[model samples]
Target: MLISVIIPCYNSEKTIAEVVSLVIEEIGKMKGYESEIILVNDFSSDNTFDVIRDLCDKYSSVKGIDLTRNFGQHNVLMTALHYTKGDIIVGMDDDLQTHPSQIPILVRKLNEGYDLVYGKYPKKKQSFFRNLGSKFNDFTVRKLLKKPKGLVASSFWAARKLVRDEVIKCKNYNVHLQGLFLRTTKRICNVDIEHRERKVGKSGYTLRKLLRLWASCINFSIVPLRLSMLVGFIFASLGIISSLIIVIRKLVFNNIYLGWSSIMAALFLFFGVVLMVLGLIGEYIGRIFLCINNQPQFVIREMINVEEE
Candidate 1:
């Protein structure tokens, strides 16, 4: 069986070569399994692609892709999935955090009749902020994307070819791999693994990028829109009830004072809720417009050791 390992490279010129070497070494020990490495340079502002090209030249099974722009990691992964020819697909980070040594554990777990296997870290080796962002992301995935409770999701994961085929069918510009995987199959499992410290630069995800990724959850579910509707209904019900109470107070106690200040406050509160609901609706519409316009999920700048399809 052929196992394809996909890594989305950012500013990782210092560590990608060693990552490829270790992956090759690990797969070399699996007697019946061969390996193919797919390195995607996500428009890194460094010599990351150069290193990828060199790795492609050195290994016959290695392929490199250069994106026209820094499509997010999930988009780059989607692009790489299009070119994989392996029976099993594995995704890991360009940084050594998702270490190559743990690849076998994910692959072995994948072989246990599971469509997808995620390498969940027993203890993540990320900064406090990054870990916090990860927790937020995990919570959102479980609630919005309907991921199975207690099933951890991470960058290091392995999946069958069928899962890859199903996932690549998603042409939405907002590519959330966890959401996509949840939509594809429920046969997902997690294997505990060690998360190594970064050997190069820090993570590419900033606060803004993390929030943008969280917003991408809208692509897979309408829970947000539903929540907006629910909120509107609750507020409307409160408004009606409050109106009735005011009427009763005014009729029974003619001296009851409904202050202008309270009226202004209620107006401000309701208007704020209305504007927020409108903004959420606009977001949904904007994404639909982009998709209807056939926006490209990713544009490939170049390829090395990759066959023309």
Candidate 2:
């Protein structure tokens, strides 16, 4: 059996070499089959690609993929999947935190009759807001995808090549791995894996980045748009009831409709609700517009590839 380990790296100059070395020493010697590492550089502005080149030079089995530009992590991984040649493939963060030590365990689980096996970090180290955002995102994903509650998802995993093909076929400018995880198949499992702190540059994911990710993710799920519809109905009902009261007071109680200000306020409120509902609906429509246009998710300025023997 051949295992293909894919490490997507971007500005991870500090810890990548060590992580690659660790995987080579600890996980590459497992029984039954051999393993090779495929490190993809997502157009980093640092010496990351050079470092990967050096490593590839030192280790003949190591493969290096250089993206023309910075396609988001998921995109980078998705594209890199097409180049992988292994019976079972593993994807992991280039940072040392993902723990290559678990590669053998993950592959072992895959050998025992499982389509996909992912890592579950005992604890996520991030700020309160960051953690909260991730959990909320996960909750939204589970509900939108119609899965059980608290279904955990992670980056590091081992899976058949077919599953990766399905994921790559799914095209979207904003791709969420967690959503694709469920969309790929109903048979997915997670195993406890060791986690460690980043031993290099700070994480690229920030609050603004998280929000962008959320916006992209939510568009794929219809749950939010459904909630928007329910809200529109409630607001419309309230608006109708309010108008009835105004009419009743004007006809029965007189003297109460004595103000142009109230008339203007009612018009504003009515149109405001109408516009809001339209805006909500338009969000979904806009995605349709983009997809119909068939825009490219990323532009490839140049490519770096090494032919396999």
Full-model lDDT for every candidate:
0.92, 0.77
Per-residue lDDT over 1-309 for candidate 1, one digit per residue giving the tens place of the 0 to 100 score? 999999999999999999999999999998799999999999999999999888888999999999999889889999999999999999999888888898889888988899999998989887887888788888877889888989989889999999999999898887888888998999999999999988877878888988897888889899999999999999999999999999998999999888999999999999999999999999999999999998888999899999999
Model 1 lDDT at residue 6:
93
- In the range 106-200, model 2's lDDT, one tens digit per residue, is 88787788778888877876567767877887776677777556457777898987787787777776677667767777777878888787777
Instruction: Tell me how far the alpha carbon of residue 268 in candidate 1 is from the true structure, in angstroms, after superposition.
Output: 1.1
* Lowest lDDT block of 10, candidate 2: 300-309
**RMSD of each candidate relative to the true structure:** 1.1, 2.8
